[model samples]
Target: MSFESEESKKLGGIKLSTLTQRLAYAGIKEQKAALSRKATDNNIKQIQAAIMLQFGKLPAPAKIWANVRHKDFTRQVRNFMWKSIHSAHRIGTFWKHIPECEDRGICQFCNEPEDLEHIVLKCRRPGQKEIWALAKELWLKKHPSWPVLSLGSILGCGLTTFRNNNGQPLVGASRLYRILISESLFMIWKIRNNSVIKREGAAVPAHEIHNKWLYAINLRLNFDRALTNHAKFGKQNSIKTPLVLQTWSSTLMEEDKLPENWIRAPRVLVGTEQQSSHHPSPPPGRRGRNR
Candidate 1:
């Protein structure tokens, strides 16, 4: 039955069933908007100054979601990516700006300022560089022409482009790119929190970080496999499985269940000679120093 000509749906005591509720909701929304405006306008300039100094102008809204095809990543990881894009995720440098407390904003491992970029991409804390280097290597293998990563690009590279050297569109690779960057960033955030919060200054090893990365990617790859595996094999498959299989079968790996191809980023041997001048090893006795 049409409700337009009848009494509206009602709830306990509230005018939820009627146009009155709509008016109430509008009033509430307007009040919230006005309060927010008052807050920003009347507050000290520190909030704006801090944002301008560190993250710069707000990033433009993402023009695309390159991972629209992939559905295996968790809601939490996606949320982290959303925050990372605008540089809203917390880091030591952000804490240092608060007027109530004194934080030096230095990275515990590198002694450099611990900004979001440093923690997510360049942190020399036990596991960070190795994890990122592995992420970069795998990303390059799949997308050899992708530009060297910057903090901004790491967060939003999926929307940046999907092309190669000749500018031809690289259609499906964008999904893989999204996983590589977002998963790597998520792992780094975990490592950072472990060092700062849970570990209470203890270092997390590179291999441990590598293992977590492995577990995460393997989980997603397996989910993708299950999706693309046909009902003819036994169980119901996702509707998109056929479409994904058409493009995925020959590129990333040969075997249907093989995760090694997609999760191939290697773990850095903590003290290996690969740690060079630019990414120098810490002195003999320092925590997280290779060898």
Candidate 2:
């Protein structure tokens, strides 16, 4: 309550700007450090348990966090994954304490309290189901069968490892999984927001979801292609050409017709089987349309 400490007052009183600045900075740093000392929340504990159950190995919290921020992930994806792990999204129980808005926590289709896990993995909603189906179809092109996925696996995808017959890391395949998981997860979230906030909870059409997913994957392909330009991104920063090719290898349309380096190939599309009957067959020599 007093403006002056005896020593400070002797020096220059409490009006001493330099001392005041130092004290304020130290208090801020101490408060910041206190955040790390707080106990982990149930959301994080659940994610850790899910990771162990799905992966058969548990990672430290720091490693999981680092994996979420992998450079392969786009900025929005990194943020999404981070928020997912922290359960920072204002859904489900976040609405429970609000008097009239508690209904917002309930899924219209599932009739269950809506949470990230339900939205991304278990929702019968149009977007979640269609997005995962498209992701699986594209993934099947690379592997014999898609790995069983859970919310934990999807969130910690960067930490997921793939190995070939010789036990060496399947770098391309692993990278591809991360990209697919992060992209698909973000798309699901965006569609849910659009449906709730823009459409007043109307379900997006399945065919539109399919087309949007196709565009998303093909756009990622284009991004990978652009990153392969060593001169544009610098040799150190650019993704390797072969790695990009391997990541997308069998998934593209007309794989047999493309040149050895299809990075610059035109009109590339992921060659998944179309789920919509009305979709036209791709023109000869051009597989997936990049819309």
Candidate 3:
């Protein structure tokens, strides 16, 4: 079919760029506007100060912000992100603001406010700190140059800014990074909720959390393989440099059937192009000496 509109022909099909990055929680602007209106009576510079102090200056409204959460996550994961961002969860602090709720608004594990931030970032509850430490250890393997996370980054780590050594942007890395961050966030929340609401023992140990994350990754890899009908028989590991491998190389290198890929072919490294034709021998002294 021929083009029906001149605008379609005027420029090759390309979506307009976004200069704003609003989270667009259901009634966020109305909430912020309400805060502004209330600020005159009370010293609440609500919209500007709260967001800036907590999450740095908000970026211009960008679809990528929402895309990163929704596209990369299942329905439950998306729901979790939305609820946390909008402060609509059933945490005690939310109930505390009510005029006559029975909630004390303090963490059972640690005697502090039970707000989401306190739970995710400041809770020194036994297992919580260890889980974050383990996450930090894995995150460092992919981004060693990055520094410690601030309070905002810990809470909204899925949207944390990411780059590599030499300030080079790691293309396509954010999706995997978001997965890593989101998975850990959800896991922590699950552990805490189970303990408090369900009376299901204490928060899980860090080692268990680590293993659970690995299992989740492996399950995802297997699903990707099945979805794409990738054959197992191959001379090369297709997932060697794949994003999962790149992000979790420190741990995945030791795994046997990792990073299953749809394209089952040998991925050649750039510098190893000549190595296929040329095999190198270790200098003679070390090999002979061991023998």
Candidate 4:
């Protein structure tokens, strides 16, 4: 959509060049205003250059900033780029709002708040240290040039899914990276909540969080596996059955003798039988049965 709409003009003084540029500019202005400062001409110009670097050069800064203010950018840039530049400094401050996380006096996991850093970086949870270490190790193995070890860097790198050794995209690497980062964040969040809200003195076991992270990564990578194998793993893990399971289950039930409650119902039996059938049933009946 064009960023030069009448509504955008009314909200901000100028019309924008492109929707993306406008959106980026608007974000910077809004964040500056939210912090109780105006984006002066000089600051606006600098930000315009930054935006250009972030996204190619724009026709005009005023137009781009207007769009950014209106929040017209895509989610990827808005969440990752726009917010990263403006909100990164506030992360520690943001965590303070999490009740159990407020006191920086002691480590949340150890109840020693003495020198607690964010759970993602320096968690005191029982096995968290080991898991973080392993995550860092794995990340470095993929990105040896990365210098520091911090949750933000790890998360940022994972979200971007930086290129692999051969530069040919690693199949499912981006998804796997996201899964790893998400699992790590979730575990850290849970540990914080358990320590602060539940008053649990015990730290979250590192091995458990590591296993969870690994499971998430594996699941993302193996998403295209055969239904039978997926179901087998799902049942073993007690995870909910995916939609494919239901569709394949009814067809195969006649042939396969899988435990009735398997989460990822096997499709092998059903698919094989269907292949041998001379006449497949009507669509309506088949659809209803599958459902």
lDDT of 1 by residue, 215-263 (tens): 6665555566555445645555453554344223333433445543332
Overall lDDT per candidate, in order of appearance: 0.55, 0.78, 0.50, 0.42
Full-model lDDT, candidate 4: 0.42
Question: Candidate 3 lDDT, tens digit per residue, 1-291?
Answer: 965665543322322232223433424566756744453222112223433554476532243245436545656777776566556676755566577763556786787778777776678764455455555545554554433444344434444445566766564455555665566677778777767766644655544554555555545545433334335634343333355444434433323443343234343111101112134533433221111
lDDT score, candidate 2: 0.78
> What's each prediction's TM-score?
0.56, 0.79, 0.57, 0.38
Query: Tens digits of per-residue lDDT for model 4 on 140-245?
Result: 4334442344433333333233446676654344433444444455455555566545755655444455555555433432352343354466655332344334
Highest TM-score among the candidates is held by which one?
2
lDDT of 3: 0.50
lDDT of candidate 3 at residue 4, scale 0 to 100: 60
Query: Clashes per prediction?
Result: 1, 0, 8, 19
What is the Cα-based lDDT of residue 99 in candidate 4? 78
Q: Per-residue error at 288 for model 4, in Å? A: 49
Specify the highest-lDDT model's number: 2
For residues 28-113, write the lDDT of model 2, one tens digit per residue: 67764554234235545665776788657778888888888898899999988877776768889668868999998998778999
